[model samples]
Target: MARLDIKRKRVALTRELARLKHDLQARELDLEIQCRAMQDTLGELEESRSRYAELYDYAPVGYLTFDAKGCITEINLTGAAVLGMERTRLIGMPMSVFIDKGSCQLFFTHLRSCRLTGKKVTTEVKLAPKNAAPIHAQIISMPLPGGKGYGSQYRSIIADITERRHMEQEMLRMDRLNLIGEMAAGIAHEIRNPMTTVRGFLQTFMRRQEFAHIQSQLDLMLTELDRANAIITEYLSLARNKPVDQSLQSLNKIVADLLPLMESDALLHAKWVVAELPDSLPELRLDAQEIRQLLLNLVRNGLEAMAPGGRITLRTAVEDNQVVLFIQDQGPGIPAEVLPKLGTPFVTTKEDGTGLGLPICYSIAQRHHAQIEIETGNCGTTFIVKFPYPK
Candidate 1:
């Protein structure tokens, strides 16, 4: 009986040991699965962080962070490029350094407004980046809460609005052109008829024996009437009913043919004329007569503006798929007040000028589907006519 009892105890002990071993193995398998899941979560987090970094750096608009002192704390790639500087070098630099002198007050006011109200503020300003032309920028800034004993900060988004501003200016110019066209059509016929009748009477009087003594005075009067008639003709040219006869023509050849006439006029004014024509230029669809008139008017204007010994440069080139003609004069530049009013009817700087010359040129350019851009400063003035390439 004692042997049988010991056998039963041994069997029970073995069964308990087997159950404990199975429980330990199950716990180890669960831990391994949990470890794999943790690894996957870590991998996903890393990928998400990388994607966020790329989005922050490669955004289209410029993004910048400014400290309480208005110095740059953080800048993205686009922001650095807009300022024409390297990100590393721009760090800690004052934001005002990139702002144009004329727009400093505007930027400061915007920043102050944002900080004081703890709200978003926006402004348009000119930014003069290094090694780049001044650009019109629309800046939207929001106040950022500070942390770790720091003061309020600013986050700004900057967008380049130069093209938008140009479009606005162009629209205004077209409005002026339309108004001039309407005025020209209304009065051109009335003025030409009276001028022509007076010119005919003056000629008839000059041929008579009784008017022989005053023939010179009569001749002057006739000349004045002819001048008036010429002005009316130019004014009439602005009529849209007169269609342009366009043909594929070489601009270089046209310029070459006009060189002699331009030089003669320049010499009469005691100024030198230079033509810079490229050896090869693309042909353009244009009205040859109108283009000739445009060149004559622009060159004559340039020559007239200069003093003796001043030089006028007429150049033709291809730029950005367009044909360009530029007339530059070494004058004291256009007056500030007159600059904005250029190409308007009867807006002239010369005492004897009827102010119709530039307006006529503008009319011709518009008919040819071209644009005229003027640049003037203390040094001189340049008129650039850009014609689109034939489709």
Candidate 2:
């Protein structure tokens, strides 16, 4: 009886140990599943962070974070690119260093507005990046709450507006040209008729012996009349409806025909003229007289700008499927203020200039469906005329 009772007790103990071992195995399986899930969740989070970082770095517009003291706390890749510097190098640099000297005050005012109002602020400022031309930028900034014991911060977005500003100025200039065109159309013929009559009578009197005593005076009067007539001709040229006779012709031939005259003028002015015409250029549909006038005006302007011994280089090439003519001069660059108003009527830098020369040049270019561009620096100035290929 004692042996049977001991066997029963051992069987019950074995059953309980088996049940405990099964329960422990189930818990281990659940723990392993939970560990895998946690690992997957961490990986997803890391991936999301990486995507966010990429977006921040490669955004089109610049993003910048400035401390309360206006020092750069953070800058993205685009921001660094706009500043013409590296992101790591831009950190902790003063934001004003990249701003135009003229716009430093404006930048500070923008920062003050953001801080004082604790709201979004907007400003247009010029950025002077190193080794690059100045660019116009519109900056929109929002005040940010302090974090990690840091003082107040500001978040900013910068958009390059240089091209937009240039377009606006060009539109304004075109509007002025249109106005001048209207005025010229209205008054040019009316004024020229009387001037022609007066010039004719003066010429008649100059040939008379009765007016021989005042011959020099008559010559002066005739010369003045001729000047007035020439000015009227320029005004007529500015008329938008002026006719142009387009013909398929070689640009090199035109330059060759004008070379002797250009050289004569250069010799008179104690300057030199150099022509670089290519032999294998495509024929362009052009108004020969208009092109000749354009070339002469540009060459004369270059000659006038230069001092004695200065050389003007004339070059023609085929670029980007367009015929390009370059009139380059080694003269003092145009004034910054005068650059934007180059094609506007009555805007002149010379003492005796009528200011109509460039306007007429612009008008001729427009009539020919060509574009005239000016590149001026401290060293010199170049007038580039581009004509599209004939279709």
Candidate 3:
């Protein structure tokens, strides 16, 4: 009986030990699985870091990082190249230094907004190249998060968009000029028959000298016909297919010559004409006829801007190797909305005006490689003509 009891106790002990061993082995397996999961997580983190680095280094657009104080901290190779500076040199330098001096004020205002508010900003600006010539840039900036205790920093993506912008402008200009040419050609052909009929009738009627009482009327009609012919001539001039006849022409001489003629029409309105120009200035390579006609159109527009007893000033100056001409009038300044599209054909602020004057002026300026700018306010409007030096 004692042996039987002892055997039963031994069997029970063996089963209990086997169960404990199984539980221990299961725990070991679980531990190994957890360890593998941890290894995978670490490997994934490393791969993500590599991918971010690759993107940062290989971005096509120039990337840059700057502190709130405008000092550059890090710049990609592309950024350095765009700025025409070494990465080491760019670092610690104020990013604003790269902005063209003429536009720095505007650029800084936009920049300050992004830095202080942690907002995103974009601008199209001109950057001064190594040779001091300007190159266009499309820049995007944003506030980036940084390490704890580190203040927010700015990151920029910049692209050299000079050629792209130039091409776009050229294409638009060509389209506009083409449309003007088609219109002018069509109108010239249409007016030719009427002009011939008027000329023949005037000649035949004038030979009847016995119609002395009607001579004055006949002369007036002849004058009107001549004016009509002049208008046609100008319309045809707009479609000039020949290259611009570039010659050094004095802008002051042109303006001076046109003053008497411009004020003649305005005499009925009793407006005062003002001329502010120096004795002489350098000449520009220009088409004398085109420029004179443009000036006439602009001055006539100025004259029509005012009521009786208003003032008009035509001013000229030499600025930085460019001919600066201003036609200002104390009349109803152009509306802000219309200022941008003032050069578009058939767009006019005046009820009776054809709106072709400015478009023609713009085309002639383009041929001369000149820029036309308009500044209008409650006080007055000024049309500024800036002619570039011939290349």
Candidate 4:
């Protein structure tokens, strides 16, 4: 009996020991699975962090953080690049440092509005970086929550919009050109016919002795009619229906032929005309008469704007795949108010000017699928006409 009882106790102990071992093994397996899961989660987090860093540093739009005082607190790599500065150097600097002098007020206004409204504010401003061209940037700023005892902060995104603005201006210019062309086509003949009849009768009356007392008046009438006729001629030039006769010709040779005529007019105004024609230039398809008209108008316009001893430079060069003709003048630059309305009909800066010359130039360029760009400053003005190479 004692032996049997001892055997039962041993069996029970062995069973208990086996149960304990199973529980330990199960717990170890669970721990191993959990460790692997933790490692996978850590790897995912690391990868996500790296991706975020790259995105922030290399974003297309510049990102900047500012304090309540409008000082830059942080700048991403893209933002630094846009400002043409190192990221480490930009931090803690005033954001206004990079804004153009003329646009500083605009930036402050945007900053104040964002902070006061605690909302997003957007504005277009020109940012002038050191030794770089002014950049047109669309700035979007939003207020950020401040920590305890801290003032409000801001986060801003800046996108370069210079090209977009240029495109928009080009579209507007084309629209204006189309409108002018339509108006010209509708009015050219209607206005010319009446002027012709009036001028013919005035000429007939001036020749008779019965109307000799008012002969001066008839002459005046004739002069005014001639002026009116000149205006109508310019209007006709803007008509899109006018056919263009394009022939492949040397631009340099044409310019050379026109120089004597231009210089003759320049001599009258005491202005010096200089030709910077290259020895050789690519031949382009051009309307000889129209190009002559265009050059005459531009050169005369430049000559009229200058005082005695001023210089007018006529230059031609190849840039990219286009031929560029530049007419530069040494005169007071075009007025700010007048520059924007340059090609509009009846807009002129001169008192006795008919305001049709530039519009005619623009019309000619439009017919040729060319582009006209003007650059003016306090020093002078340069008119650049670019013609595309034949495809």
- Residue 79 of model 3, lDDT score: 81
Runs of candidate 4 exceeding 4 Å displacement: 1-60, 67-70, 94-121, 126-135, 142-154, 239-242, 332-341, 375-380
- Model 2 error, position 9 (Å): 10
Q: How does candidate 1 score on lDDT?
A: 0.87
Question: Tens digits of per-residue lDDT for model 4 on 18-92?
Answer: 999998999999999999999999999999999999999999999988998899998889899899999888889
In candidate 1, what are the lDDT values of residues 38-83, reduced to their tens digit? Answer: 9999999999988987898889889999988889999999899999
- In model 2, the Cα lDDT at residue 172 comes to 78
- Clashing residue pairs for model 3: none
- Tell me the spans in candidate 2 whose CA falls farther than 4 Å from its real position: 1-48, 116-118, 130-133, 145-151, 307-309, 332-341, 376-380
Query: All predictions: root-mean-square deviation over Cα?
Result: 4.8, 3.9, 16.7, 5.6
Cα deviation at 233, candidate 4, in Å, is: 2.6
Q: Which candidate is the best by lDDT?
A: 2
All candidates in order of lDDT, best leading? 2, 4, 1, 3
User: lDDT of candidate 4?
Assistant: 0.88
TM-score of 4: 0.74
Task: Tell me each candidate's TM-score.
Answer: 0.74, 0.81, 0.54, 0.74
Poorest lDDT segment (10 consecutive residues) of candidate 2: 143-152
**Lowest summed lDDT window (length 10), candidate 3:** 234-243
**Number of backbone-clashing residue pairs for each candidate, in the order shown:** 0, 0, 0, 0
Clashing pairs in 2: none
Top of the candidates by TM-score: 2
In the range 224-250, model 2's lDDT, one tens digit per residue, is 888987887887788777878999999
lDDT of 3 at 303: 79
Q: How many clashing residue pairs, candidate 4? A: 0
Model 3: lDDT of residue 154: 78
